[model samples]
Every structure is written in structure tokens, then in C-alpha cells.
Target: MGALLVVILALVVGGCVCVVWADRGGPRWTRVVAAATVGSGRVLRRYQKSQRREVGGGADGDGD
Candidate 1:
């Protein structure tokens, strides 16, 4: 389980690096990887925000 987790993390990090490289004018294949990476990041961000809302009752209540 631990090894699997490490591999998954490595892949995610690698994808993110490729995305950055593509943004800097990397090869065509990198551009494809970059698009997928960005899309996945957006999805993950949305999911995380929803999870936080559920756990926090949709408000921080700190008056700000």
C-alpha cells in the first residue's frame, strides 16, 4: 500500500512538472500532458473545496 501511494504521488508530481515545462514551450507531447494535468488539478481543487465545505458547515464564522 505504501509503495503504491509513493508511486501515485510521484506520477502526480511528474505531471505537474510537465505542465510547467509545456507552459514554457516544451514539445507537443508535453502540451497534451499539460492539458490533462491542468484539468485534473481543477477537478481536485473543486472536490477539495466541496469536502471542506461539508466538514466546516459551509462557513468559517470568523467574520471575514
Candidate 2:
């Protein structure tokens, strides 16, 4: 399980690198990776927001 977690972390980091490269016009293939990166990021953000709501957390801008 530890090894698998490490591998997944590595892949996520690599994908983020590809996303940055593609944003800077690295190559055509990088564009595909970048798209996947953006899509996954959006999904992750939404999931996190939903989880926060379930835990009764307000939007991140409600500091007093």
C-alpha cells in the first residue's frame, strides 16, 4: 500500500508538470495530459467542497 501511494503521488506530480509545460506550449502530447490534469483538479475541488459542507464548514471566505 505504501508503494502504491508513492506511485500515485509521483503520477500526480508528473501530471502537474505536464500541465505547466503544456500551458507554456511544451508539446502536443502535453496538452492531453494538461487537460486530464485540469479535469481531475476540478473534480477534486468539487469533492473537497462537498466534504467541507458535510462537515459544516462554511465557504473559505467567512473568517471573522
Clashing pairs in 1: none
What lDDT does each candidate get? 0.89, 0.89
Range of the 10 consecutive residues with the lowest summed lDDT in candidate 2: 55-64
What stretches of model 1 exceed 4 Å from their correct place?
61-64
TM-score of candidate 1 to 2 decimals: 0.79
How do the residues 1-64 of candidate 1 rate in per-residue lDDT, one tens digit apiece?
A: 9999999999899899999899999999999998998999899988987787889976866452
**Cα miss at 16, model 1 (Å)?**
1.8
What would the TM-scores of all predictions be?
0.79, 0.80
